[model samples]
Target: MTCFLIPTVFQAGSLSLIMGCTPNASHSPVFLLRGFSGASVSSSLLFLLFLAVYLMTVVGNMTLVLLISRDPRLHTPMYYLLRGLSVIDMGLSTVILPQLLAHLVSNSPAISASRCLAQFFFFYAFGVTDTLVVSVMAVDRYVAICDPLHYHSVMSRQVCARLLAMSWSVSVVHTMLHVGLLLPLNWAGDAEGNVNLPHFFCDHRPLLRASCSDIHSNELAIFMEGGFLMLGPCTLIVLSYVRIGATIARLPSAAGRRRAVSTCGSHLTMVGFFYGTIIWVYFQPPSQNSQDQDMVAAVMYTAITPLANPLVYSLRNKDVKRALRRLIGCGAVDS
Candidate 1:
């Protein structure tokens, strides 16, 4: 991705200031993304893998969303949250993978600074949205099992809409604040006008490393603010499951316990897979973080999760399978 680090004359505030109001003799209008450009691994091989993943992601999420929308039986709180999750998955993958796939093949792939910044904004926004939806899904499960009699009243249509609105609002505010923090960095660090991002996408971590000004402040924001965004929902999921476990344990029979766990099994698997990749990329200290591994693991959520959502959340669901069968007029076929 290419970022124009050409020194802009200071105007005290706004975009000029955000672009690092400074004087530079030379104008560098492009940032060359060196994403796997120097690696010995076969670029074609990697391209095919990512392309397949992206295709599956697009097809799978689209199918899930359509299946949910067309099926009257899926008009419930859980499926509502699931539709949101699928949409975010599509957004997240779109923001990262297409550009990454391009860079993997080209000798000197580049992106405009504005596009890069936009990518950065959506990446975090969708990521935050994903976590919030996952947490909410956990709560939906908790209510469904622990208080089945009151589930509908508790997770009513209005309540689910409000939850979705709150999640997007929180995510947008969080993304805007951080993107603002990153804007002033283009001209801060380098005397040579070199402000290229090292990662495949305009990942904030690499952007922070590229900036030499107020590094501590940026880390603090990521750890304190971003951590709250990440961990707070996680804490909710953990507590919800703890209660769910307790409720399942009190069941009278082994069959009952199995049934209860089965209800949560798919959601729990998704939570683990999603958060496992997240922690792999985010939890480590910057000094010890490996970008290579981070790039690979990012595929899990960006592409793999979306690709798997149909199977995990919908295809395996008997109701959804029945709906799919009916959609295609194959009622006699086994799901």
Candidate 2:
């Protein structure tokens, strides 16, 4: 509890500092290519890799968004959640890709302190937003499968809109709370700025470690925000799935039950991967010190999963597949 409690105060103060209020930069050395242990990487290879992933993530998510929007068949609560997820994927990737590309190509790959904070701000913002969006999806599915008659009214258009709005608002408040407090910590000036992040983007723990001053505020903010953000939505997802499972279990026919389970299973897999990697990365102590391990987790959430969302939700889904076939009007979509 103390671990969770302390960070809340730090986040509160940090948020106060980030409202166009500049803090003096600490003397953290700008490492252009530190090593795999730190975020150091060769300009050419990293940029190429980032470019490929960026294209895939954008194209995949955008395609899903388009398919859902254009098709009348997809005008349901579940597809709406997928659409929200696609938008978040687009946003989260865009927020990080440009700066990452700049850092990889430029000889002096350095982000200004303020810009770094801004990157972390939106990174966490949209990431949290995506998590909540998926949680909403779980609830939608639960209602749809568990209580069919009420599903229409319960997850109606207005209700869906409000949920999406609330999710975005909550994400903004939480991200701003942590990132804003993070801006004030003196990083460059202090000698403790040796911590290097492995990934391309600026993230909370990595940026916090780069601070050269007292990290009491930084550590506290990390613990509180990380705990609340990860736990809150995760709990909601679990609860929704549990009820959904119970409902599926009650299906009269075995085939019906199997179909219901399969439909929900893809979404559940996505939820687990997204939440699992993110929680492990942010919540665990760094002493696990697995740079390789950490990078893998980062790739799962940031790169791989975004690419997989369309495939995971749309490809396997009967409704989506049918809509896509109608939209493309081809013999069949490429395997």
Best TM-score goes to which candidate? 1
Could you tell me which residue pairs clash in candidate 1? Answer: 1-111, 2-31, 2-111
lDDT of 1: 0.72
lDDT of 1 by residue, 130-226 (tens): 8788888899999999999999999998898899999989989988988887766543334544456656777765565554444455555665677
For each of the candidates, the C-alpha root-mean-square deviation to the true structure, in angstroms, is 7.0, 6.1
For model 2, residues 1-335, the per-residue Cα lDDT tens digits are 00112223334344333222126455433433232324456568777988999898898888888888888888888888889888988887888776667766665555555566677778777877887788888888888888888989999988999999998998899878876676556544324333344456666544544455566665565566667766777678789888988888788999999888886877887776666555555456546654454455556666666777777877678888787887789533433
Q: What TM-score would every model get versus the actual structure?
A: 0.84, 0.81
Which segments of candidate 2 are over 4 A away from where they belong?
1-43, 189-199, 276-292, 330-335
lDDT (0 to 1) per candidate = 0.72, 0.68
What TM-score number comes out for model 2?
0.81
